[model samples]
Each structure stands twice: as C-alpha cells, then as structure tokens.
Target: MNLISCAALAAALCISVHAAAAAPVKIVAAENFYADVARQIGGAHVQVTSILNNPDQDPHLFEASPSVGRALTHAKIVVYNGADYDPWMDKLLSASKASDRRTIVTGQLAHKQSGDNPHLWYDPSVMPLVAKELATTLEASDPPNAQDYAKNLQSFLAALKPIDARIKAIKAKYASTPVTATEPVFGYMAKALGLDMRNEHFQLSVMNDTEPSASDTAAFESDLRNHAVKLFIYNSQASDGAATRMLALAKQSGVPVLGVTETAPAGKSFQRWMLNELAAVEKALAH
Candidate 1:
C-alpha cells in the first residue's frame, strides 16, 4: 500500500472507463440500403455490417454463410427485409440468438405478408417509418447519444422530401401510365407513381424462377411488339432467359426501357439511389 501504487491504480481505472464509453454500437443489416439508413441515423455512434452488398449478384439466389452467423453473435441491432424476400435470414438469426439483440423487419413495418412483393424499400413511405424506428431504437439502446439520434432522424426525413416531390410530380403528370416490368422488384414504387403495371403473372414467374405459360409469354411479347406499354422496366441484376429475351424485344420495338436493381449500388446512399432512379424514370417517360 504505497502512495505511487495507489495513484497508478486510479489512473488505470479512469482509462478503462473512457475506453468503454467510446466503443461503438455494432449493427447488422440483411440489406445494404437498410444498413445505410442505420448509418445515417446512428452516425459515429454505431458500426454497421450489411450482408447483401454486391450489386452484381442476384439477391433472390443469396445463401448465408458461417461468417454471417458469426457477425450476428456480436450485433446489438439487426435489420432485415422479411415477407419471404430473404427467408435465409430467418434461419441464420434463429441459429444465433442474443438476449439483447433488437430486430427491425421492413415487411412488418409496412404490413406486408409473405406472398406480397417483398421489395418493401421501393415504397417511399417505408423508409421514413424505418428511419424513425431506427432512431427510437438507437436512443433506447444508448441514452447518452439520444439527441444526436433524434437530430439525425430529422435530417434523414428531410433528405427524402425531394423523393416525395418527384413521386407526386410523376403521379400528377402520368397517372395510370402503362408500364411493364420483367420482375416485381420495383412494383411498389411503380404503384406509388400510379402506373398501370402489366403482365403480373409473367413477372411473378420470372421472379420465382418458374417459366411463364405460353399464353402469358405471348401476351407480354405482344404488348411490346404492339407498343401497348409506354415504358419497359427490366431487373438488371437478376435477369433470366425469359426476361433477357423480353428486354431485347422491347428494344427492337423501339419502346423506352429503364433498368432498375434490387439493391443500392456501391458508394451511393439510399437517398441518392432512389432519386437517380426517379430521374431516369422521368426522362424515359418524356421520350
């Protein structure tokens, strides 16, 4: 019990406390766009990992690995797109259970069911709900940073104003505009814009990796050849033989085509990605 020994012990204790306070909250999101939103809200207070980040890969064919399970073990918050879009996430989460882990399901937030179009993020209203929920969750988990979370939530919502405006402008100008897609990935956004989406059976068949009936296929082709729809949207990330052929036919018929992807591209924020797609839609419709 010397004076020097006591002083050294007190300094070590203080250093340990400061280090613990500075540690960032760990979050894992099934999709990168969700992760991007979490980052926008959490800022420097959180560390995020997104499993489906590759824009070139088809997300429908995604399979989880052991490392993803390991990542979940240390996470305090987990975000996922449910409603059968990422069914593999269910299995991975169930395998690694944590008492303190909080999960946010976009499908549940939007009241979407298993058979509904699982790309819930395409809906403009869905992200605001997600951002609010994320802010509330972050505040609850780390009270010290509550004010920052609330401020970030406001910024995130404000950032979405342009997107809402664009949708309103498009809907006002072109409500019920005839459009067809190779898959249902952009169905929700298209609905928001008041589009008359055609060929549901064919889109669903291609999405589920099944062959569309001869009649359904013929109808889709006829629509393209006769220029029934004003615009053709193709899921560039997950195209099959049927979708590819339809895309070619649409071009041959001189119909305007737009390419959309299921996931946000690398280095683009969720807000920028949506706005860019909207701009492209506006340009194509004017053609």
Candidate 2:
C-alpha cells in the first residue's frame, strides 16, 4: 500500500506544480490602448482585460462596475492612465489591496500630473515608455519567459519608428501651423507635430463637461469661420452642442476637420491606430 501510493502522489504534485507555473499572468488595463500594448509585449504569456474598450463610448464618462473590481482582484498587473484620466481605477485598486500587484501609470511615466492634459497616449514618447515598463514588469514577474518578453518589447519599440518618423516629417513641414480642437484629446500629438493649438479655455471646458464662457465660444467659432486655424480637430467619441456647432462651421468655412478619439478603435493594434491617425493628419494638412 505504501510504495505505490507514494509514487502516484508525488507524480500528481509534480503535474500540479507545472500547471500552476504555466498559467498566464493576468493584466487589467483601464483603457484598451494600454491593454493592446500589454498584449504586444506579453504575447502568449499574459492575459489582459481592458475596461474602456468601446470606441463609441466616452472614456471620461466611464464608471467602474462590480465586474471590473472582480477582475482587479485577480489581476497580477494593472495599467491605467493616471493624472485623473481614469480615477475609478485608483478607487478599484485601493478597494482590492494586493501587495503582489504592480500598477503602471502611463501619465506618471510621462511626467504628467493632475490638471495637466490627461490624454497621454497621444504623446509619442509615452507609449514607448509604457512598452518598456510593461516588458520589464513581465520579465520580473515571469523570469522563465524573460527572453521572449525582451524580444516582444524590442519589436514593439521598433514598430514605433514609423510613427516617430511621421511626427518628425509633419513637424518639419508644418511647425506652428494653426490648429484648433473641440477638446484636448489630441493635444499631446498636436504638440509633438509642432502645430499651434488654439482655444485652450474652450477645450478644457468641453473636456470637463463644463460650459465654455460665451466669449470663449465666440472665439472658437470665429477661428473656424475666418479659417484662422489650418485644421479643426474635434473629439469624435464625445461631443456636445458646442462641438457639433463648431464642426458644422468648419465645414461651412471650408476648414479641414480632423476627428480624433480618446480611445483607439477595435481591430487595430496600437501601432496601426497611431499610424492611421498620423496618415489622416498628413492628408488633411496637405489639402
């Protein structure tokens, strides 16, 4: 009874240990774009969940649900756009205190703070930083797969070269070209491209869902009406009457309008999404 029973028990324990070690790391990102980055770097080694994935929904309006909290409870790694962009993530993390969990705040990595422009993913420098940090986190968490994580991270960084080149070319050709946006969703990218962005007060008001002062509204309209801004960008995901009116006015005045979303669309990787947006900007500026 003793010899056969001991051998079978040891074999079962060995199999259990291997299965546990082979389980994929779980990651939860507050936004889908970050999840996409996690997927790129993690590949098959991680399972990622993105809270704000719907392109049609406004991320600013996101409220965390119970399921999100449950996901956070099981997540080994968490990523979120900080600087108050997705404050709900902070609340959820605090509620579920796990000492082993690692949280990567993209805004903090970008040296952004509260009251600063929170649309940080649009910053060309931010995502590369995020990718590196994500790879490092994965390596530290799963040393057995460190080499694969490093390779994926390298590929992810290399993919950004075209995006960087696009930004450089645009900046060289269109530096200081006047542009205006209904919201600051693309503010960082616009800054990278060296475009002159106008109507800050109005954009902040719209982003915060506050009423823009009458004078600020008038100035925004005047810019569009007079073709003062070379390009007019509106937050396509979230809009109000003021934004809608400005969009129509831009069309009336023959100003080129570009729509940028706070969240990336589905079926596109982070790299592809950025490239597409950059291409659109280049197209609009050419016309």
Candidate 3:
C-alpha cells in the first residue's frame, strides 16, 4: 500500500479508539446499595458513583451539592429508589434534560405498586430485576460489549441465589416469629420472611422521623415486658433515646437484640453485611 493510504488508515483507527474511550458507560446511583449492584453488573466497563454513604443520615434529608450536580450531568445511566425517596435525584435528572441518559427507578418495577414500600432492594426478588434492567441499560449504551454485560449480570443473579435460599430457610424455621424494631428499615426483609412485627405503630412513627405517641410507646413497652417479642432489631446508625431504652429492656427481658444498619458496615461487602445482620436475627430467635 502507498504511504499516504497507510497514514490515513492509522488516523481513522486512532479516532475510533478515542471516541470509544471518551464514551465509557457512566452510572450514578442515589445510594450505596444501587452503587454496589451497579458495580457488580458494570464491572470494568462502567464508572459507578453514589451520593449517600453515611448509614446514620436520613436519605430523605439529603442536600444536593455541586459535585452531585456534576455527577448527574455526566451520567449515562442513573439508578435510584423512587416513590418520593431521593426526590433530589428526580429534580436533578429533570433539570439535566439529557435525552440519551436512561434512568431506572426501582419503584417502577413490576411488583412495586403505588405507595408500596420504596425499599425494594431489601425484597430479594427486586435485586435481580434491578440487575436485569441495569444490564439492558448498559447494553444499549455500549452495544459492542453487550455479551460481557450479560455475563456479568448472570453472575450477579447467581450470587444472590444463596441469599434467597438462606431467607427461605429462615422463613421455614421461624414463620410467624415475633420481632420488634425501632423503625421500618428492616420491615421488608422481616415481612418477606413471615416474621410478625410486634410494634408497627412505633416503627412507623420512628421511620418517619417523628416521636411515637404515648399510646404507641406504652404498647411497645408492654409488649417487651410481657415477653411478646423474641428479638429486638435496632438500626445501630439511627438509634435514639427511645430505641436505646428499648434495647436495654430487651436485654433485661432476655430477648436477644440484633443490630442492623442501613448502609454497608465499614469493612464488609454489601452481601456479607446484609446476610450477617439477618443471621444475627436468626441466632437471637433460636436462643
């Protein structure tokens, strides 16, 4: 081939590589749970980002920062829990007006009805669906690597099977077992496993960041003293004075206490942290 022809071909190849590298898949997740899932599915192909890392802070009260706006602006795909949770993400996505960016709202999943619990990830069935949606979205954005993305997604789904099996085993062993929690953070998992919640009113009030009424507090205390509950599930991150009192009561009453946290605890992977928390509950119930 002529020198000129060879030079032109090299230039074209360089341009193609540059364009591909510049458009790597970008994902922004509203919370760490989605972030972890995205990382598992996206692997080395996508850059995943999350806004909330603090387990103690209420996501409802999150304030958007300039960096968050920049992340939203550049994301090729966004994943968030909808249903008025993380409303800031919706506002930022609307303002960005990026037509090509695909947003996956967990609340839009098939089983998620309006006013249904926004904590979809805790429901074992929901994560696979989210992973599937993420794979589809990533495939659309980077069609050249669609096969790899699908493989990654399949692996993620398979990894979750053990967790599902564990949950089933727990349900079989402790159906209708009574448990109490300071808030609704563990409600989805508990309900899915058929555990009876003994203090619904108190949980709802605390989950909404409000003070439980006198009647609700009295009922919760009565249940604890009467030994109506086998275990006390507390969100270690969001513990308050009332929750502290409940924990003490549980210890005093010989009811085992299980400490749970919303975000992934310090050194543990997301899956390990979650399973460990549930295992602690199982241990408490068995004692």
TM-score of 2: 0.96
What TM-score number comes out for model 3? 0.90
lDDT of each: 0.94, 0.93, 0.83
lDDT of 3 by residue, 1-287 (tens): 99999999999999999888656689999988888889988888889888888877756667999899899888999998886667788888877888788999888864566545566667777778889999999988888889989999999887877788889999999999988888777888998889998888888777666888899899888888898888888877775777888889888988788877766755555577668877887888898
What are the root-mean-square deviations of the candidates from the true structure over C-alphas? 1.2, 1.3, 2.4
lDDT of 2 at 228: 90
- Tens-place lDDT per residue, model 2, 162-220, is 99998999999999999999989999999999999999999999888888999999999
Name the best candidate (by lDDT): 1
Query: Which model is ahead, 1 or 3, in terms of TM-score?
Result: 1
Task: Give me candidate 1's TM-score against the actual structure.
Answer: 0.97
Give per-residue lDDT, candidate 2, residue 59.
82
Give the TM-score of each candidate.
Answer: 0.97, 0.96, 0.90
